[model samples]
Target: MAGRKKTFHGVSVGILMVKTGFRRLPGDVGHAGTWDFPVQYRVVEGATPDKMMALESSGLLDEFKAAALDLVAGGVDGIATTCGFLALYQRELTAACGVPVASSSLLQVPLAHRLIAPDKRVGILTFSRESLHASHLEAVGVAADTPVEGMPADSVFVTAIKSGDTVPRFEAMRAEVLQAAERLLGSHPDVGAIVSECANMTPFSADIAERFGIPVFDGVSLINWFQAGLRPRRYPQA
Candidate 1:
């Protein structure tokens, strides 16, 4: 790649993955669009951040930090963590990686807010209200009071992510998400967009858009845009 002329973007992206099971791979995000930039990823030790924190409840994470630096070593211009819940470690993880790191798609909050009108606001879709913290919004540059709604299940998309040969209870899951989204928009009435807080929820974006008639953002889309900005195309030779 070094010897090749800059026929495309000279920059690349890196991802530090949470230790979710095989069901949570990131193939879906890449399909949203051509990344143009090279991508490198590595998994840390944990089934998921939800379970990882539950397992240890510790504030320090030395192992995940090492994993983050390893991916950056591949020449990626920036980095993003795989799970939104990892926002708890945003400052620490970003500091450890020594690069631009997205601790969460929640960052969309501030960006989306700017895109939205003053009268129309932005909303979020995640696992549960209890899981979110003021720092999560602050990390993303949105107010913690910003409207956020999601599945009643404590596990949220993680359930579907971990779905098996049984195909998951998507029908029921879809109903719940749809209801939550609809209720949120209906109640807020002035929401300009909805951000899917879970990466696994990308497949349902079209449905959300069609049902709600508003812009719907998901982690896959968020990461794609974030990665693009950090490693934009420099296809001078294209």
Candidate 2:
């Protein structure tokens, strides 16, 4: 038999990172060590967290689409983004880059709902409720009226990430996220699962799941799944 031709693809997933100076802890999407597979990263210039939270990320679609194309050109098998708010640009990015684009964790909402009982629905914990518009949810196939809770505007997580500050106190950020999760559960008692809409919130996903005894999904988990499709597992022959 002829030898298989060698391929030089370096990574399976390419991340479209937001242009921010905030500290990304180990589990955060922006942190390279968060993934088990080699992944590429390209920051979308001017796509700041604050601007995105304010629904201004639409202005940076061209920049993100261009970055996705760059990653595709570099041989990445799939693409994802660091901010869930980018759900608004998923279709455009997928069309432009000609690759599977998992632009936001919000994409898990529909699947989460399907995984749970009919009476129980998926709830979202995000960085900004006011900023998580119906358009963003609808674009990602989430219900327009889905229950959502947001981190406190004055939270350490919000302040640090939004301002691009490099000092995010992990403990405080976790506490704030827990508060948001609790609030989400309190207000939406039928929520059987949680989906965090801020990619940085992935660091506390396990904590949220343990505390609430419910499934928690986030950008990191979604990205990992997406990468698996890009490079599916192969079993060794016996």
lDDT of 1 by residue, 1-238 (tens): 2443332243466666665543433334423243444566667764455564342364436767777776666566677766677676778777887678876778777777788788888988876666766766776567867887766654445455543323444555566678889888877888899887766566677778998788887767777788777756678784
170: Cα error in model 2, Å? 0.7
- Per-residue lDDT of candidate 2, residues 154-216 (tens digit): 889888887777775799999989999999999999999999999899999999999989999
Q: Which stretches of candidate 1 lie over 4 Å from their true place?
A: 1-11, 22-38, 47-49, 52-56, 154-158, 162-173, 235-238
Who wins the lDDT comparison? Answer: 2
| Runs of candidate 2 exceeding 4 Å displacement | 1-8, 56-58
lDDT of 2: 0.87
Model 1 TM-score? 0.78
lDDT of model 1 at residue 39?
A: 66
Best by TM-score: 2
TM-score of each: 0.78, 0.94
What shift in Å separates residue 45 of candidate 2 from its native position after superposition? 1.0
What is the Cα-based lDDT of residue 231 in candidate 2?
A: 82
